[model samples]
Target: MKVFDKYILKSFLEPFLATFFVVLFVLVMQSLWLAFDEIAGKGIDIFFILKFLVYLALMLTPTALPIGILLSSIMALGNLSENYEMAAIKSAGISLKRVIRPLIFLILFISALNFVFLNNIYPWATLKQKNLYLNMKKKKPALALVPGAFNTDIPGYSIKFEEKYGEEDNLLKNVQIADLSQSKGKIKVITAQKGIISTEEGSKYMTLTLENGNYYEEHINKSMQPKDRAKMPASKATFKTYTINIDISSFNDDDKLDDEKIKEHHGMLSIVQLDSISKVNKIKYDEYTKNQADYFFNILEAKKLYKYPDSLIDTKLDSVILNNFTTYNKSIVLNESIQLLKRTIDHNKNQKISFKDKRKLLNLYDHEIYYRISFSLACLVLFFIGAPLGSIIRKGGFGLPMIMAIIIFVIYFFISKLGGNLSEESAISALFGSWLSTLILLPFGILLTRRATQGMGIFNIDSVLDNIQKLFNKTGNKTTNL
Candidate 1:
């Protein structure tokens, strides 16, 4: 029995590691392509880029784990069944369940490790990755400039270039700039046949030296007088060389903003921190509901405090009182009632908005908490599904197993994402939304496992089609008799 367990585990480990790294690499490359726009041509440090890649890989671990486990389990068990090892074990009086017992224990351990990653490592990686990306954006503002596009990184200025060259990217050809710093109604345009850009170390300014350029300054409606504006002529100058200096010191500052100032993003908090936040948000939500209820009660009491006879307070307005009251008195009463109702409406509207915001925050915390558990358990759920499905299929190797794993995972991913969106919108309770995918996968895993143990294939298209045809023939015979 010990030797059998070891052999089964060994088979699982080989494909498990291979599938994990392959899936991880593919996911990382996908993420890199998505972020290429932000990182390319940015002149960012190589070390920073490496950090970005590492954190991104870490973030993708949870997403990759379930699929890897599913593929590996399917391949391992299918290989054993294909080679007739499983048949030998069953013939020797060992049940299929008994054969899988050792692997189940191993899967449970991996599930626990996945939870550790989610609770500690995942959150840390999420935080560092976000902050580092923001720092990179700040450190390389010049990367925003692309040839043939109007670059607006500089305040009150827009620059365009037909072409740019050189290792330092200092040479600019056919440069055009529009300056709008001085007056809103005036325009200043500068064009150069060729230009060079330079920045001084530890300086707050960047200089643009242009050769063979023209400058145009035009003022529309000068002096705010129609006649004077028409007479005031536009100024134009042609020059062989010109220079412009702009401030860019903000890009050089290495002082990254403190994470504390951002008030701790929910995605970046650990299990302990999430628990504390959920509790706090719950208290706040309860308080908001209580205060809103009390507010309405007070408004109703205030409306009653107005001096009115019991006779005048009928559910239906009293016709006698309405007829007896003078026009002036009637007008005064109507105005007072209208003012009170308007105030009540305003208060209700404000309270509704406030309560809604608090409840949304509470829902976020709840979703996060449940998400940690559900995603962690997904590993074990997928394992049961994969191992049984492989045995039933009796197909081994990456080709067929990869397709099966991907189809199952895609369904899981789509359902989980939909549930998350619904929970975030408060359309469903956080607990239900977060656990929906796990609940769906659990029964599927159980069904597959049962079929495998019973020596029945889960998918038998030909058998199903033949059964349908037989039913149709019976229906045809009944129709003929009628």
Candidate 2:
């Protein structure tokens, strides 16, 4: 039994590693394609790019793990069944249950490890990836420019050039720079016949040296006046040689946001941190709700000022007494009531918005608490599904198993995403929504396992239909006899 368990474990491990890396690689490539526009052409260091990929891979582990498990389990079980090894073992007095026992223990262990990863490693990777992307966005855009296009990435400036030459690509011809740094209504245009763009070593500045250029400046009047009366300021100058320096310190790769600050987000909080923060937030939420309720109640009470006689007035007033009030007093009361009604409506709107925002914040924290546990347990649930499904289907190899795994996992992922959105919006309890995917798949897994144990095929639709037809025939014969 020990030897058999070792053999089975080895088979599972080989496929698990292969599938894990493949899935992770695919996900990372997809993410990189989407981010290529922003990260590429920026002259970023190769080390930085590699670091980003590593962090991204770490962040995607939770997503990749379940798929990897599902596919690998299917392949392992399918291979055993396809080769008739499972039947051979069962023929020798070994039950299918015993054969699967070792694998089940391994899956449970993986699930627990997934839990720890979710709590610790996942959050750290999420924080790093988020900060890295933000830092890249903050990088100066001048470094991302392409030839022949108007690059407006830089604030208050638009740069364009006709051609770029030389091994270092420092040489430029027909350069045009528009400087609108001063005001919206003013612009300074500089045109150069030929130029060279370069950055000083160990400096935070970039310089453009032009051999021959013409500078034109224009200022539009800010006053509201007739077009003829609006004064326009214009200036022009010609230079044999000129140089312009721009502060490019923002492009420095060393500048990074503090890790602690980035980790303050809810997604970047560990289980322990989330628990502590959720408790504090819950207390604050309760207090705010109670205080707001009381405040609004006070407002409702104060609204009674619009009514005459106040406490002295009976709930059921006589028509004569009510009609006894003067028209002037009635008009004054109506005006005040309208004004108070408007204020109440506005206050209610703001209160509703405030409460919803607070609830969403609390829900997010609550959701993560359950999200960690659900994703951890998803490993076991998916394995139960894949292993039995593989046995029932009686197919092995990457081809069929990969397809089935993707289809099943996609359904699970979509359901989880839907539940997450619902839970985040407080439409459903966090526990129910977070566990929804697992709950839905659990019964299917049991059914598949039962069928496999009973030596039944995965699908018997024809058998079900035949039984239904026989039942109908028997009912018809009974009616005829009656």
Candidate 3:
């Protein structure tokens, strides 16, 4: 019995790992094949290109593992059954449940691994992949153009060449530029007979060695009645051997603003940071509320005091009271207006402060940070579902399993993405969006696992079809309605 348990466990472990690698390979190979041209044209290094792909595979693993595990498990068990290994065990008086103890443990251990990757490692991979992609674009932007292809990089700047030379090293032949500088209002086409790209220390500049070229430009040029600038005249320029320097610094990836840095800015924020922001928000809200209360109370008190009549008062003593009352009332009015203004201004400031209308903005940041983590963790969910699905599928080969895996993965991917959008739009809570995929698949996983382990029929497709036929049956009982 001990030997049998060890043998089956070893079998599962060996093939599960094998299947996992195979699936991971297929997904990544497909991606690389699709993106190969882009990578090569961009002058991307073999090492970095492979590294980028590795992280991509890591990001994808959680999605692939479960299906591999499922199909492999089914094949492993079915083969054993066909060979009468189960019968041999039954004759030895071992119950089916006891035989599966090792598998159960295996499931628990895999689940734990899934959780760790999802929570930590997976998020790190996501961050790295994004950063790497940004860097890759920066390092080799010339990849965007193919030789003799029209390239549009800079806005209002378009270029075409007869040929490209030597691995983004340089270019040769006819070059054309559309100069809208004079007719900046309208496009002016400028064609040059020749041009050369030159590197200037820290920057890349395209220097045009123009032999003969014509520049067309148009614009409103003149000090005009400020309102009549619309009626201004147009202008154009044609030059030979002219030099124009584009601030391609912005075009370079290095100098461009990074969106990831902004997102992860507060992502690494400590609990202390969160608390501080929350505390500041609380203080502003409280101050606004207090000022509002004071304004209303001042109005109430002013009305009450002013309503006291002159006829009810003694002249000598009441005159002092009356004078003091008038002064105080004016002071109160002034104070109220100032406070109201302060509150209004503060409200406007806070309106844009992002704590009011965007109560979920901070929460959204939190959500975004956790999105990759949840996906990584999805590896575990998929595993549970995949393993059981394979057992029930009972097809002992890769074809059926691969198709089923794709279908399940597609459903999982679509729903989760939809949920993520809903949460970001604040249509649904962030936590809910992140967890919705897990919640949806968990029950199906459990159900499938139990059915597979217990040897239950997977579906009632035949019965369901039969029911459809019966619903439209022409044959009917002739007995009177009872």
lDDT of 2 by residue, 74-132 (tens): 99888989999888977989876777789899999989988988898989988988888
TM-score of each: 0.79, 0.87, 0.56
Q: Answer with 2 or 3, whichever has the higher TM-score.
A: 2
Alpha carbon deviation, residue 75, candidate 1 (Å) = 1.5
Count the clashes in each prediction. 0, 0, 5
TM-score, model 3 to reference: 0.56
Where's the lowest-lDDT run of ten residues in candidate 2?
252-261
lDDT of 3 by residue, 201-314 (tens): 766554545546667654444444557755656455666666667555544544332235423433333334444665565567678667756765675566686667666464
For model 1, residues 254-339, the per-residue Cα lDDT tens digits are 44522323337787888789989999878877887888778778878856766765654566776886799899998999999999
Q: Rank the candidate models, highest TM-score first.
A: 2, 1, 3
